[model samples]
Target: MANIKNPIIPGMAPDPSIIRVDKDYYIATSTFHWNPAVQIFHSTDLANWKLISYALTKGEVNLRGTNTPAGIWAPHLSYDKQSGKFWLAYSHMQNMAGREFNSDSFAMWSDNIQGPWSDPIYLTSIGFDPAVFHDENGKHYVSILEWETRTGYQAPGHIVIAEIDLEKGGIIGNWHRVTTGFTTRGCAEAPQVYKHNGYYYLMIASGGTGYAHGIEMGRSKNIFGPYEANPSGEPIITSSPHHLFSLGDPDSGHFEMYNPKSVMQKAGHGSLVHTTTNEWYIAHLMARPLPNTKLNPLGRETSLQKMTWTKDGWLQMIDGSNLAKMEVPGLRNSDATIQSDQLNNIDDDFNNSRYDLRFMTPYREQKSSWVNTTEHPGNLRIYGGNSFFSQVNPAIMATRATSLNYTAQTSVSFKPDHYSETAGLGLYYDSNNWIYARLCQSDKEDGTVLRLLQAKLGDRIDYIFDEVRVPNNFAEIKINYNLGTTQIMYKISENDDWKQLGDQLDVSYLSDEGVNGEPGEVGGFTAMFNFIGSVDAHQHDSFADFDYYKVINK
Candidate 1:
């Protein structure tokens, strides 16, 4: 009977972590600084999702200069069914510079959910979203958030629970803190635990992701708890519930705000699944913001609601209400075939071995000498390493302009001719903002030239086109972005027709949710990238032949 109105999984998917296995369903998200991080999806009828595979592709962790929401937070995803394995739990948020929140928590396991996975296993410096549960009797728990920088306690955050051994990485007992939620909302973090029937529940994520997020719950017979809340004490799911007290600050008793009226804004982290026919759902994490203008550009997405259970067993929402929507009934549509084009085709002729799950690379480790398929078989040879503001290293490989009216074309045949080679085509949003459209050579005018630089935030480098000679061998470069009205166009192809070398760029501040409050604020957490870079400081072996790289989405 499908038709709750669609939107089973749309853009920017955030902290969701579902799992089913018999009827097949899987989901995992959260990629803070965006590398190869964690983003996996696959569904049967939870309403179509597809994009399977990506659980971090080794760099082993070191998100070079991470910031703007800090690299990789929340990420769970379980499945034990008695050692059929599949676990994953994360948090690598290395320092938020003065926001302090240092972070480390890790764990990984796989028997197969499409993974070779199994290197990370640090598990716990504790202070970032981490969840893992196994107990039916086999035992293997982990639920974190001990982070509390001290001071009269209460709101520093606390909700521990331990008992894991996984071949001696440690954690045998004594950690239990349990209930620290429900004051109004402090910073209760992604916790998750379940048992059902006899009850054990748990499921947290309280205010403070912005606008007082929520999704609380508690219950206990034993698993280590006194737990109770949920007599409608509030937050069964939210999106502004009067703003939840506003979420965390009553001298830190928590639940700071309480303003639920709904239009979807910072809904709450969540996960819980059942459906094979048993029915039940809650995927959570929502945020639309833009109508009145809060500007959230698809970030924090992944929604679902539809729940039941309460003969007094508790667990509402099936229309009982707490916000969270986009349809949720018995659910069983998705037979596949909903392609009006799901938008994602930045065009590349690299000839796959895998590297177009919408490319992304920053903060180190993804080197085959910048890129290579044995040099040039189908074309994708980007060598000229180091230099993007070098946080450690940079060769760059982006993708994600998804839409705002688009048109990014590329075709280069560079020979930058020395003086630190440089191959072009970029739009990036980090390392302090970006915008490039290069194809250098001019060393006092002899040939090859076509520039239009700008680096902002990271500082110095603003050329805006100086040597425009067009047809310099195998040229072709286009940018075009409209984004409603930020207007930017830069074409170059001359005689074959494309002229218009530069001067239209208003760049509406390169949004995704950027350009709001600047001055050491830097584009609010990123979401604008479209690159193909190379910057060798005169090590020069120079090779750039990208016969194709399209993206057209008006």
Candidate 2:
């Protein structure tokens, strides 16, 4: 089974949401404020995948100060062959300010997709990608995205669809706008619903998510809709297949709809799946920039496409070309065998106390108080929080810089007696961009140096004459990065040779169009991260340990 390439799950794993439930497929992505939020992946070979679970681990939701693409956005995973259970639908976007994009869509369930889940059920705050469609006789709709603050109408709204009564948790009536986009590339949000053959189709995600992202469709035998579009009104999947008039644009950063011959760029938020050998795949959400640079520091990933169905049922892209393809053609005769560390390079060595569910942590909730591998059973302590320009407790742990060229080492032992403590290894992209190199506490004479700290767009530099002295706070901190440049190295033994702690630093602003939001928007859809952080702010008793994080992949 080879030929299944294009990110079958790579890096930040954006809007995805696939599902299968029989030969086991499961996808579900978008964890906008990190943490054990949404994510969930597992495959039986639609090209090997496996991050297992996290349907919002338990606190169920509350991404602290959440703002930077605003926490937990699209996570719809459905499965209910007549209440066999497993639904999930999400969105807790909580305010995007003057855009009034405030959100709160929920819905949860689980008879186990690897969950204990079953708490949220709220269902609508009016806008923000929510999906949930399980119609057949057990009826239950719930498409969403009605967010349009009428300045002229149709800027980013209207996909609506209701009739959800999950045993009486709300919405069994009004809300049915349906279709503000069938292409001319409007900012139509994620809709998703399907019924096939007798038609009830309706899939969306158009134009906005940068560079004219797409994946659009429509049909109807009346699931509520006049739904008919898609006779090549364009976009059945896209990496900018030309012709874009942008209907009321402003979902942010159309960047002139960049498609320099496509290396897979913003290929739309999709999620379709059929395969049990009847085959049909779509798992979308792509972005790869950083060469001639439109700069996407590995955020928004997860691709796969190979659809087909058109005798008059319409759902193209199986070489019919709506563009977007890095190689797709597996699972039709399936031999299944492609998981040699699925996409390699994340060598973690925290030695069994466990710490690699692809370690995420950003705006809080990794809890063990402040992260712990059972109090350093082998290493990976991390106590010190706040200060990485606090988005409330930045005790970073990060992971997901999935290659634009990688290197990322780690070795911190950290001992900062003050100067507000610090620990090392960096990259991150929130709390206003980042670079960080840190080791701290030299304020001119009390030892342990290594400094670098930067944060663009929200300002804060502090290289402090590029300090370097590290004689024993234990050093190893690396970073290579490449593509948009970044060098920052160090060494203190284990054969020593790294030493380059300065120059070469462009970091392409850590990128999601390089941070800075809310005043004309476009910054952070959650991407680049390498992390290993710490920061005491004076006696949280400091803590960093860490002895092994390695990321290799060049």
Candidate 3:
């Protein structure tokens, strides 16, 4: 048997929904505030994954003013062999302000995976993280979390199941309160339903989404009824599955529930898939934090665990231990060859007519007017729009920083006439928290100058160490990210030795549990990104031509 690595898809690819059609595997993940919503990844062996297509194209959703940790949430993908169609169910998180968590869910269908998908069919806005289940009778059912707003209720609310009509885009009848949770491990959401054996199984993400996150299961002979919890009386699988804590806590982030012995933390929100080999596996979201700390700057990532059926008919990891493993056993004699350079390595020469699907922009659709590789062959031309601080529209293109230790570099030739017009390579957690090393006009000289700046919750800090005047408009910028600290380096020419712009900046605050000064805010769940961008407050006509963009993970 081959060894399947954990975190099959890393760097912010959370809430994985997996499905298998013949020999192929596909997993759809959430893209908060990033355009081209609902990233779809394809994998043949489950070890190596590649970005293929997005469920939503431009004009599919409006994320113009979407805030941190809000936008497209969980996306569920399923294929109906009987109908020969693919269905995608997703939630568009419009607002999370004041913790109202207003969202709209919709479903789209296509004859093919990579498709001209049909227009969205409006689904219920009961809560979020909706999934479609097709039974043997060819009927469709939706399992969703009914978000409770009233005080003194089950804090985050229950998982409800209801029959839905695909064409009508509405429930057939009243919703069924299936279960609050299989166990007292409350804060259960992201419910997915599957029919196994003669029983119907309900899988949920429980114990909050922080240190206590886990996968819980219950099964019943009926689709909507009183479900019985797994005999373990606790999470069937989790990073801290052995650490019994918070069976009664009503809120999330029971930081005490963190499992120090395990390498994988916050392992939960699993989706199950049965392969052609009849092997069972669950794809879940797990986070790998820095050593001896819970600071997860990489955010929740996608992980896999080989599963098996108990003699009593419940599903669980093949091993009796519930702890997530760094390596899982693969199918015997499987011939899936994985590519060597799919994660944490990006070399973009920008000669292609279209931008790589790996790159994404926040809060707005990537349009040719703002970003174009064809405009300047071998270079990416990005015309500056509003500042990155503005969520409405920002001229930025980035990829998830899959590794904490990596070097991100870019070659740019931007002639910024004013300080308001700048272009550079940097790291971004959100508009409120980001560090950009930009080249702009020098007030002290005729040539451009490099400056390192940091924005934390709209407050800006400009680093003034040693300002170097560029000999020409062309400059090579590099950022060496070492765990939570980053060093910005630059040189006038590629042949010249790199120069440090500022002392290493501590950026540990740019994480899911950090930043965002809003009261009662749970920080942001979105991970950090490596970006190449420009800010133009002087004139929108200013553009930056990036000769190349590259990132090498250490």
Candidate 4:
């Protein structure tokens, strides 16, 4: 049998919603503050997955000025077997000031999974983590966490369900309040509905999305009303299965609950599916820290757990433990040759007439006006937009940093007339936290130079004294990142030996819990991204031609 490993989809992929249609399985994940949101992956053997398409591709939502971890939340994908249509429900978290948590939930339907989806139909302004359930009677329902603003009420809120109308694009009636207390673990959200036998099961993510995160299940004979919690009185699956009383706590970083024994922590927010062969599995989000630290640079990733139903109709891990496993059994008779494509690295030549689907941009949609391959054949031509600090339009094309030890390199040809124009590669966590190695014009020397710039907690630090003069307009830039440290390097020619540009900088601050943000909240959730970007605050006419970009993981 194939031994399905943990983190099936690694690096910045979180809040996974999985579905199976026939023999094909598809998963949709959250993309906070990143354009082309709602990443979709397709798999056939359940052990390997590939990026197929994205949902919000055509400027469907405006993410301009979106803060870290405050854009797209959970995206729930489900297929209506009766109508033969795929439905996606997601939350656009607009604001989080004062813990008000203002968000709008919307749904879009398409005849095919990879599709020309219809415009987003407004569902509710209730809360985040919206999930759509297709009932057996041709009825549709939506489950969401109702944000609680009152002081004494439950901190995060309640899981509520309401019947929805697809054609009318609204709820049919009042929302039914489900039980908020699920196994004493608080901060419950991402409610998903599933029907089995003669009962309706409501699965939720509880104990926050931190060290104590887990998946809990409840079931009711009716769609809504008096759902009974799992008889185990604990999460069905978690990295830290130890008991804790954290009710009413809305904090997303439960550092005190960190389990040192498990390599995979923050395991929760799961989506379930039953294979055609009657085996069951849960696709959930997990994290692997940088060895001895609580900081997770890779962010939340997708992992799979083998599950089975009890004789009394309760779901539990296949091994009958609440602890999340790093390895699980796959198909009974399937070959074990399946492997993930993103485990090591990727190299893109930009020769294909189209941009790689794995490449994504933050704040703004990737359009040909600023980034395109057709402008210069066999090269990616990027016209610098705004500075790295601007959440409006930052001309950056990035992919997820999947490994702690990896080298990212790119060759660029640019001659900047002004000091504001720069082009090179860097490691980005958000607009406020990044380490950039850029090639720009030096004001003192009146020549091109390569320098390193960093932004930590909104403070900009420029390595002015360490700037290295480039001999020509063309240079190769590389960043070697190991654990929490990184070093920038560049070479003037293909045969020239690489020269280190700066000291080995400690970049552990570019992590989920290391940066600065709203009080009691994790700084960011999108994780580290290796990107090639340009900035042209001068005339916005300067462009950089990148011949290729590559990432090699050791």
Best by TM-score: 4
- Which structure is stronger by TM-score: 1 or 2? 2
State the displacement of the C-alpha of residue 125, model 3, in Å, after optimal TM-score superposition.
Answer: 1.3
RMSD, one per candidate, in order? 20.4, 20.2, 1.6, 1.1
User: Which pairs, if any, clash in model 3?
Assistant: none
Once model 2 is optimally superposed onto the true structure by TM-score, how far is the C-alpha of residue 456 displaced, in angstroms?
27
Q: Distance from true position, residue 513, model 4, in Å? A: 1.0
lDDT by candidate, in order shown: 0.69, 0.84, 0.86, 0.91
For candidate 3, the clash count comes to 0
TM-score of 2: 0.37
Q: Which pairs clash in the backbone of model 2? A: none
Best by lDDT: 4
lDDT of 3 by residue, 179-229 (tens): 888766787899998988889999999988887888999999999978999
lDDT string for model 1 (462-483, tens) is 5644557645545677787664
Give TM per candidate: 0.35, 0.37, 0.97, 0.99
Is 3 or 4 the stronger prediction by TM-score?
4
Ranking of predictions according to lDDT: 4, 3, 2, 1
* TM-score for candidate 4, residues paired by index: 0.99
Model 2 C-alpha lDDT versus the unseen true structure? 0.84
